[model samples]
Target: MLPTATGRIERLTLPETDQTVCGRIALVFPRTPVAAAENPPAQDLVRVGEVRRICGAQLRNWGLERFDDSVRLLLSELVTNAIQHGSGSQVGVRLSHTPVEVRIEVRSGPVNTLTARDPGLLDEDGRGLLLVDALADAWGVDDAGWVWCVIATAAHGA
Candidate 1:
């Protein structure tokens, strides 16, 4: 069992696979409490905001202001997408940084598949992944509902 931000105890069933991309490791976390299946907390948005604030501070500390806007937008899009489309109550986000790159990952409950679609010019939605693809140095999705991307720190002289 793990403690949530709300101080509630919840269980997680992580996958055994140890995957690496761009020198960053991938971690899979189960969605929130399975018992209260239907009434999942709407904490994803709050978490996204928290992550943005944290990343913003970290970027400032690292002198990577050039990438701050991109990181904020990409993270927000990925987390929002997971909360809206994924099939679980909880979401997990991980950020790992190395000398050369920073990796961002968002994991959620079971999802049938992850795909990027082209949105009509008039459509307001369906552009999240497109933005991610454009901004991220590398990005992909796994069968286990893990979506990740990497940003090159070297680009910002970090």
Candidate 2:
């Protein structure tokens, strides 16, 4: 009835035939590498594009194309922030789906602070988390230094 991480199968028995059928329900999660902060800026840009493409494809596979624009924008902002502020060498991106929503996570090196702030009108920097707050149903940084956001599935009124 419930899916487990260890990939367990459930069996159902039919009384009339005295037969049993076994089946497993599994959720497939896709992880894509967005970029390496150590890489050249141009290369990082290319990696960001690849991450966007992969996310689009994954969302389409789930029949959630309507969320593509929001996903793309939020993911891009997260990746950019990781590349710019994170301390580690590489940025990793992951997309997972549940009954209610789709979650996107970006992991990089440690961050000095997780707080989001408003930027002055003429300022060219900052505002990444602002966009995320406005678009994502929920967003936050985990203890392991991964930044994650959830977007409601189309069926859930996203």
Candidate 3:
């Protein structure tokens, strides 16, 4: 069975040059603002797992199950970061893949600072980006506050 999206999924229109790509799925998550509260409720965290399931299903549907584990982990980290730290009310996750690589992009409100830090061994957090850096072939934050990563699948012989 296919996983369901917590928000909504839309099919994106790629350029002519991207027609060879197997598939693409875009998910939009709207941050549920609390009434006179400063932070989102704990329930919001559920979206993280939902997104992972959606990502895995999409990969399987594309005949790219080999990437399900890494892709889902990467998607989880990025989506978690966006939900926890982003100031924007909406978060967007875009997944697209070519014959050799899969691209994941997470976008939210404008952030003046975006960086990965080395945390102490005892620290429980701050390792999200580190995981992304280690697993992704390439990753960066765009001027528009979009955090994007590319995981090359050539090593998988796909």
CA lDDT, every model vs. true structure: 0.66, 0.65, 0.79
Candidate 2 local Cα displacement, residue 82, angstroms: 1.0
lDDT of 3 at 149: 94
lDDT of 1: 0.66
The residue pairs found clashing in candidate 1 are: none
Residue 127 miss distance in model 1 (angstroms): 0.4
> How well does candidate 2 match the true structure in TM-score terms?
0.71
Residues 41-145, model 2: lDDT tens digits? 555556566677777876887777888999889878987776666655556566666667778877666654577788999998679899999999898877777
How many times do residue backbones clash in model 2?
0
lDDT of 1 by residue, 26-139 (tens): 223334443323433565346567667776676677666777898889889987776566666556666666677777878666655567898999997888988998999999
lDDT for 67 in candidate 3 is 85
Model 3 spans with C-alpha error above 4 angstroms: 1-17, 33-40
Stretches > 4 Å off in candidate 2: 1-40
Show the colliding residue pairs in model 2. Answer: none
TM-score of 1: 0.70
User: How many collisions per candidate?
Assistant: 0, 0, 0
Off by over 4 Å in 1: 1-44, 111-113
RMSD of each: 5.9, 10.6, 4.7
Candidate 2 lowest-lDDT run of ten: 21-30
TM-score between candidate 3 and the true structure:
0.83
